[model samples]
Target: MAKTTLSLLPLILCLLYISGTAASANFIKASCSATAYPAVCVQSLSVFATTIQKSPRQLAQTALSVSLARAQSTKSFVTKLTKFKGLKAREYEAIKDCLEEMGDTVDRLSKSVLELKRVGKARGPDFLWHLSNVDTWVSAAITDGNTCMDGFAGRAMDGRIKTSIRARVTNVAQVTSNALALINQFAAKY
Candidate 1:
């Protein structure tokens, strides 16, 4: 009996591991489905699934951090682009505009982070209000990113710069959208 039990132990462990992974994936999918960009939401937040442990507040905080980090990186990228040689006046202006927008985006995300923290301490209706603030700020951050992208529309710039800026800003927007959705989900529970 001991020998048979020992032989089954590894199989049992493997099955448990697989089951845990499946459950984690399902949880991420369910949470991300609340967002507009579900695939991006899942991809961004799934990495932290184990650590997040299915806490809606933790999920919102994680999403905010991710969005803020991406916005900071993209802001830096756009600032550097302003220095690139041979840029036309319009291109330089566009880059500057994007830099300002990114700054605002970062600010909104920072506010959302604070709002999420407040949600933990506040009680009842106050908690709900804080969550609503977080959702609104995150949504505004997404809009800021989109407005930055719109600033570049129809501009005849170098393909490389255009593609790089668009990709980075789009990524920031998507993560911000996810953060808003997570905050909304958290609010809905209360």
Candidate 2:
């Protein structure tokens, strides 16, 4: 009986782990449903389910982290595109302006992530202030993304460059928008 019990232990543990992971994933899926871009939110964040679990704070932080990562990568890609020739003067200028906006976006998102880490430790009015700061920074980050695209908004903007930049910027913005939605849900529950 002891031998049989020992042999079953590992199998039981494995099953438990699988079930826990599934539960976490389910939590993420349901939480993402509240976002503006549920599909993007789930796709980008589902991989971090184990870390996020069912905690609203964790979910919000993870979403902000994901958005920051996407913003950083998109900024890098746009920077690389600047090295190529054939872009119109205005297009080049727009890219430069966008790089600045992306920088601001990254900085704001970083601040929000750090601020959220403190929200759990804060109480009453302090908690509200920290959460409000996170919300404000995230909203500003969204605006930074939109402002980047605005630099290229005229008829003379090169189509190919415009198309590529717009797509990437729009994606990051959408992802950030989802993060904001998650943050709002977190706030509401508080």
Candidate 3:
């Protein structure tokens, strides 16, 4: 009986470790689930869980960086879309409008990244100010992405173009919204 109990101890410890790991992974998914697009949030952020740990500020900064990169890439994609040949006048107009809004989104995301960086280095009362800036910029980025999609609403554009643009813009918006939620969470800790 004593031998059996000792043998089971190792198994119990291993089970405990496994459970703890699963809980940690669930923590990341739970945080992501708080966003508008839980799947996107989890996919984009889960990779950074080890580095992010439980730091709200780190999570916010990482989210901002992801959003910035996506916005920049989408901006480039939309720019090329504008130059696509054989577009009708209205289609061209819609794409052009989308391009402009995407540009704004990119710019706002860039600003958020910068502000988040500042927030990371800040250690005084000014931290709140920098954090607030990050929140505002991320919100603006989300709005910019939405505005881009709004341009396509009711427009008689090619179905392919419309779908492609909507997917890209929605991806950016989801990421930005995730960043904003993280920023707010961090701010509340202050």
Candidate 4:
């Protein structure tokens, strides 16, 4: 009986050791996966910011091509808030805030792109400078939109509000695509 009890003790210890090792491995894997979310968030933000920065330029170009009366200033285009009928005043206010926040983000990103170019010129590596500029612009656009969308509980609002938000998102997508194209053009030239 004493010998059997001793043998069982060793088996119990071995099982405990194995279980701990597995738990630690699983923990490490989960920690690594959790850390990756911020990086993904940053990348997403950058893409959105880049899109916002490019939208005005594309809109301006289209306006010019069609000979439509152009806004005397780019900032004018930035604040073109949409008015949706059937939305509550509170909903309208929320939408306005979202748009304003997004617009501010776009403006900041545009400035960052210019600043990157200036910094690149001052520094030695031209390629790195251009890449940095593109990265900054993209990051700014995405971050701004995400920030606004984070606050946008308009998903629960009326269909009009939802539709308006969708339209804005589509517009952002178009701008992002154009910015990517512009980046490709720059790359080709380089």
- By descending lDDT, how would the candidates be arranged? 2, 1, 3, 4
Write the residue-wise lDDT of candidate 3 on 1-190 in tens digits. Answer: 9999999999999998667656656776777777777788778987777667666777778888898899889889999988888987888888898888888888888887887888767877889888777778778778888878776777465489899988888888888888788778777787
- Please, what are the lDDT tens digits per residue for candidate 1 over residues 49-127? 7766667778878888998999999999999999999988877888899999999998988888888988899998898
Which 10-residue window in model 1 sums to the lowest lDDT?
150-159
Give the TM-score ranking, best first: 2, 1, 3, 4
Prediction-by-prediction clash tally? 0, 0, 0, 10
Candidate-wise lDDT, in order = 0.85, 0.90, 0.81, 0.46
Measured with C-alpha atoms, the lDDT of residue 158 in candidate 4 is 47
lDDT tens string, model 4, 60-169? 22212111111112223324434446657766676676677566655655554455345434534766566566556655665555555554464466465455564565
lDDT of 1: 0.85
TM-score of each: 0.85, 0.95, 0.82, 0.43
Best by lDDT: 2
lDDT of 1 at 36: 91
Task: Give stretches of model 3 more than 4 Å off.
Answer: 1-24
Candidate 4, which segments miss by more than 4 Å at Cα? 1-90, 112-127
Would you list the clashing residue pairs of candidate 4? 45-142, 45-143, 46-138, 46-139, 48-141, 48-142, 49-140, 49-141, 49-142, 50-138
